[model samples]
Target: MSPALTAEIAQRFAAIALGHVRREYPNKPGHVLAGPEDARTPRELHPIFYGSFDWHSCVHGYWMLAHLLQRFPQIEAAPAIRALFDAQLTPDNVEGECAYLAAPEARGFERPYGWGWLLKLSAELSLHTHHAWFDTLQPLADALVARFEDFLPIATYPVRVGTHFNTAFALRLAADYAEATGNGALFSLLCETALRWYGTDENCPAWGEPSGDDFLSSALVEAECMRRLMPQDDFLGWFDRFLPQIEAGQPETLFSPARVSDRSDGKIAHLDGLNLSRAWCWRALGKAIPEDDPRRSMMVAAAEAHLAAALPHVAGDYMGEHWLASFATLALEA
Candidate 1:
């Protein structure tokens, strides 16, 4: 990385750290703590203003924090981030129990929505930060394993669905955490479960059938997890086959656009925008792309163009600051 790029990454990381501390968390869970100076007040956050917090929003925040920490390891913030996540451990914090949330929180609501959210959160936190603060995750893993038979057959709405991306997230998390914990059996179990979803055969045909924006996200996540766990040769082949489509600037059938209801705003389709879906591909491919491939440069150029366009629209110093800055860092890293 060039000196200029290095400096930019550092600034962006600091901004993310500061913004979360100052704004987003101030009136939420970590309000009592010393956060960033520019923290968003309770009035400014719409959901919180309405007296409710989206479970996935909290999950996303944890994921972003993990991403930033992986880039810039800070011992000081580890505990706080860990604690913020800890707040949602109860069942009340889970999914439907927002109405039942009270006093000491319960292990996130036991429903499919909450369990899926927690499963993803725990896996990412452990995988990214390598922090053991949530020692409870071990037993939680055991419980999930015991209950796997119940959650299988990934269902649609009202059928206890385990989301595509979220399930993919769980697979990666479980694999990473299993390795970290030296639990070979658990690792294998997680891998097998994930494979059941993405494997090429009839067992995982559902996972392979690309159908929606959510499915595509899940597929990309599956691809990433496969990249991490599968042999390098297989991963390379996967990349070689699909990357050409990306390079050609054509959408692949692997990802379903139907689930992306928000894309009509044209926020995601435009190359000059920070589309998360496109960034997901860039992130995985950026690390895997061969140095000799001209497509690598094309990917970087596309990401840069998006960054150039999105820079002006980046929300306040803390709201969407980390999301934008981290990608900028990723683009520079590319």
Candidate 2:
């Protein structure tokens, strides 16, 4: 059987997130300072997401915790997760975050990457209807939705990089929020944007994959985005054209796992994330293939290979530990 998300693994992931979600000092701020007065601490800039090394990582860290809590409430970390949410996911804290976003210098702050993660976090919290976390976070989510609506129309081209700037990664992650919250406008916009950007793509070379600092696979992520947003039949047709050689494994790069040379270096640590996220994309896209298709088994094997290469390294180094569990949760759950 494929490695599934067991309660044991969920507990381990939750514990990892709890360990760093609030550790603010070792932060790498994605801030733009317009003046000396703009010089402020990360905690002051992002009250709810000042931990896990950076803002985007911290946002997705909370997402992993929320997802794990919902999936395995009986895990040892459940109570602590609940307590952390109760303490930090408050309206005041969310207001501070929104205010930071509204600043002129912060217009492009976090852009599609952090924007997508914040929405993903909101989507997970929305599942916990018994709590008011989602309600408190709705304003921020709405702000991001507006950002997407405003930005997607003007974004003439898709960012095909295998990194945070990748448009496909953001759209893939944000689709969950649009569907869960019944935001029809956002959903339509996302679908339209994806189709506009990736609809014509055919025979992707995938030559630049596993870029040294990449944490995502541009080719697979775009495929996953279409899988999430398009009708099944339409997505299948698009997939056939976009990656027509999957059955033959012609784009050999997508079938292979990336090697992480150094876990201690933050940029190089991204390879671990690249592996985990490729596993996520493969496992998810695998479900779209027919059972009788040869690509189905290939996808599963590829996912397992990527997971094996990276899962063991999810913890040891602070560089990866601060964020990799979220991607692991995504893969295991998929």
Error of 1 at 59 (Å): 2.9
Task: Report, for every candidate in turn, its global Cα lDDT versus the true structure.
Answer: 0.44, 0.93
Cα RMSD for candidates in order: 9.5, 0.8
Q: What is the lDDT of residue 151 in candidate 1?
A: 49
- Candidate 1 C-alpha lDDT tens digits along 239-260: 5553336555534432222222
**Runs in model 2 lying further than 4 Å from the true structure:** none
TM-score for all predictions? 0.53, 0.99
Model 2 clashes, total count: 0
- Please give the lDDT score for candidate 1: 0.44
